[model samples]
Target chain A: MTRVVVDREVCMSAGVCEMEAPAVFELDADGVLQVGEPTDLAAVEGAVRACPTGALQLVD
Target chain B: MSTPTLDAIDLSERTFWGAPPEQRHAVFDLLRRESPFAFFAEPQVPYIPVGPGYHAVTRYADVEAISSQPALFASGSGAVSIADMPPDLNEFYGSLISMDDPRHGKIRRIVAKAFTPRVLENLVGNVQAVADDVVARARRTAEAGDGTIDVVADLAAPIPLRVICDMMGIPEADRAMVLQQSTVILSGGDPELVEDEEYMVTAFLKAGELLAGLMERLAAERLERPADDLTTALVTTEVDGERLSHQEIASFFILLLVAGNETTRNAISQGVLALSEHPAERDRWAADPGLTRTAVEEVVRWTSPITWMRRTATRDVELSGQHFPAGSKFLLFYAAANRDPAVFADPHRFDLSRDPNPHVGFGSRGPHFCLGAHLARREIGVAFRAFADHLPDLEVCGEPARLQSSFVNGLKRLPARLTGVR
Candidate 1:
């Protein structure tokens, strides 16, 4: 299983990750990002790669 | 096809930029294939003295590598201009894009708070309303005239301009002045936009002062009575016990005015031109509205509205198999990188359903990646959805009058016909 990890320090909250994988990554009203366990590895990988700030990473 | 000699290509010349789009692409293709780290002299602008040349980083891998490492490739020296700008000009024009962290990071964090998904979600209705009004006005113009309209002016330019104005809470009376000032600031030495090249520096300074002045007044007003607008949020919001000063707010507002207003306008204008050129892709998008997401990404990739950004080497480094000393200047050509065959399949083709499209239309993965990328994407998607809904058969009537500048791949005028309307 691939676990999604977000480096909050690096995430600028551009919301690209949320757009790519809504179920795995979500930005709250205050713009704080919430990371959930990944159900779809492909979508989660896309979100990880699409993050502009290199904020998201996957840990096995 | 025969390969052209390095001497045959002169990207520094204005004539090179004014050349046909295909010709420019061919030059970049050759450069990407043969010499991805080619160096060229800086273009001689009117007031700015010609300085050191820049290595044109054309390949996708090179651009991504350089951008990902901000410490190695610094932006504080200057990011927007090849020549080092004067101190005052840098302060006025630089803003967040021209700084290194922790300054860039601090300001970005505070400003990023204003651009949260929740905040942007609130603006969706405003964006849709502006797009609808723009399309409706274009329909009226096409109906009243010869079924033709200037897409740049009628359809493309107004949506982002008005949306930014509404977001910043600028008065209706001041929006036109804001637009005019921003056009002059980002005109990129285009003769039509910045007439009288002798006074180009004066024109830029005057425009900057006017916009800054306008924002300063608004910031003061927001301070007295906080409102729900971006300016108010910017003035009041504090991060790590640091709040943006009035001057910082003014500079940021100017950055937003130019970055938010001009780049998205070009994207929409160029998107219309692209759709007109590729009717099949247009039909594909029109048939499936779900394609708006990828379609917007394709438009940004294909158009590459802001062609390139300059980054200076902070220290000696090796990049893409090339050695460079400290203080080396490199121009990351997002336009060329987007079309790199190594990264993209059939790089020239406009494929709307392009998934896994990691195009750096908004710079590569880095701290300096465009802060407004999400907003720009939303604006482009909304604008095209309006087109698909109202003018399904819209197409460009003639060749577009291109903006004569290497910095911005823009259209001064795109003659488009609303065929479905009449």
Candidate 2:
């Protein structure tokens, strides 16, 4: 299983991860994104590729 | 353009770029009416209360004064809105935008070696090739009639992204990722697109990590086999006999990415919009390709894409009779300054022949003048020339979608149709 980690403090909220991997990285009411369980590896890669801040990481 | 008294004007509710059409028209009307100077006080802050330090200068002369004298009005404190910065991330990414002289001069000199006019001229050939390819692709799509192109997407966005990536020695496979990162980083203030701060921060950090890794590898590679690319140059070069740390180098790369991408993108979009709005100007360039250079400058001036930069005062400073106490933040409005009627006759009109055009579209004068301006000029010139030669019949197919962010508001979706492609 692949897992995702996000350093929340540095996010400028540009929304690239949510754009690329919506299923895995969903934004809550506070507009903070989290990696849900059963993360999609391809989508996670897309998220990683899409992120401008480099705030997202994958753990396999 | 006569100067206005303080009692005559006020800051409008709308963010300059994101203002509604009527409000937009009204704002410019007020600008023209008020002439050189207008005072703007900040409304309630959103996330954190931006102290009463928020004030604005909308006149060209006032902006010129502030920008020219970086000693009086410093840019090193930070350029973005204060409310947006998180506490922890403030000190880490130190780019040229936040540096004062001596240090600013030293780093600027070393980095300047990479972006010299000669280097920019050399990069012109590559810029032309990439621009031609992009315009050709757009032309082909536009030739299909209903195949209207989004100038922002098809032409404006990719060319700069590709050129900067190429200059940095980023791999072809990674260009898409680079583009993605550029968009995310550049669009930080856009409310519509950027919804998740945590995700954005996480993504931002990850990009830094990835690029830092890339920089480390590139540094090693350059040590073994130096190349002509900027990455190799930066890795090898030193400022004041001190080599740039990995962190500083990454910050520099990140700065180039932001500066190069959005500014050039807006220049292309805004240039297209200008020409489309003025078919005669379009025909002028289409007829005489030589005018593309002048046209690019005029478009940059008219668009004023990066808009204003915020500077925090270190001591009580008197600018054009306005007293800003130490720690007061002043937003230097470059867009309005670019359109100052006293400086340019018929300021709003896009005249290609306007020479002696000392427009401060690239951040007025001294300290924070855009480092990537030469490359930006080349990219805009190349892109416009290619478009003029190829997509002569291009027309806006739909209302261009506006990016919501005030920091770098530009056309996000510029749908267009074209003809005359064989």
Candidate 3:
């Protein structure tokens, strides 16, 4: 299984990850990023790559 | 390897920027091939004192590397201008783009609350509506007068301006004023816009003051009334018991107006020019609207608006086989990097469906990567979709009057002839 992890310190809340994989990544009202279990590994991977700040990582 | 003679290349000359696009690209190609990490004296603009020269980071890989390491290559000194901005101007001009981490991240998080995917998803409907209205108005103007329309003034410029103004709850009466001030702010020292080079600094300061004043007034009003718009959200929203002050909000507002408004406007303007130049791609997009996604990226890649951003070395560093001491400046040339043959095959060619198109048009993958990238992409997509659906026969009738500044890839006027407006 591939897991998604977010480095809150690094994330700038650009919302690129949320836009790419909304199901897996969300930005709450306060702009804090919330990570969910990755159901679609491909989309999760894409979101990790699309992250502007290199804040998201995928671990297998 | 022989030492590259840079006699033929002079990035500091303003005339070099105003030259034809192909000529400029040829010079960049020569630099990239021979001197990927080249240095040049700064352009001598009026009022700003010149300092140490900057390295021209022309390679795609180097731009990406430098962008990713904000600690190593900091932007706090200044990111927009080759010359260091005066301390007074930093109050208004020093927004997140010119900031490094921690401070940059904190403010960005607050601002990002207003640009969440949910927030932007709601904005899509508004953007489409604005695009349609702008296109319809352009058609009416063309029909009432000659078939020709200045795409920059009449069509491309209005859509983003209206969208950004509406999002901020700017009064209808003040929309034109906002557009004018933003134009001057990002005019890139265009002779047509600034007129007298001697007062160029005055022009910039005046534009910044006008925009900042307008935003401060609106922010005060939002504080009292609490309207349902970005202005209200920005004034009210907080993170970790931290809220943006009026000064910070005003500066960010000015940033949005100049960065969000001017960049998207240029992208739309250049999109029309690119499509008109490549009729086959235009027809293909017309036939398959699905290609709007890829076509939007292609336009950004081809145009590379907001040409270069300046980054300074925080510590002594060696990159791409070159050593630079601390405080050395590097101008990451996005225009050159986007067309880098090593990264982009036949980069000069405009291919709409080019996938994995990791063009650094949006400042690459970094902390300071454009905050408005999603909005810009949506605006361009909608504008082109409008063109394909309504003005399929539109084509460039004459040459585009390109912006004189090297910073922003902008068009002052794009003469376009429209027909078959349905």
Q: What iRMS does model 3 reach?
A: 0.8
Q: Write the per-residue lDDT of candidate 3 for residues B1-422, one digit (tens) a residue.
A: 23324686788888777777778788888899888888899888787899899999899999999999999999888998889888557656768888877788778878887778777888999999998998888889888888778899888889999888988899998888899988998887888999998998899889988888888788889989999898888788775687877677878888988887889989989888888788888899999988887788899999998899989999999997778899999999999999999989889999999987888899987889888888898889998898888887787889888888889988889998886543
The lDDT-based order of candidates, best leading, equals 1, 3, 2
TM-score of chain B in each prediction: 0.97, 0.88, 0.96
**Is candidate 2 or 3 superior in TM-score?**
3
Sorted on DockQ, best first, the list reads 3, 1, 2
By TM-score, the better pick of 1 and 2 is 1
Off by over 4 Å in 1: B1-4, B420-422
Cα miss at A33, model 1 (Å)? 2.2
Indicate the residue-level lDDT of B87 in model 1: 68
Model 1 Cα lDDT, one tens digit per residue, B1-422:
45557778878887778777788899999899888898898887777888889999999999999999999999987888888898668766978888888878877766776676557878899899999999999999999998999999898889999998888899899999998899988887788988888888888899999998898789889999988888888888776786876667878899988998899999999888888889999999988989988899999999999999989999899996679999999999999999998899999999999986889999998998888887898899999998998888687889899888888888889898888767
Error (Å) of candidate 2 at residue B281 is 0.9
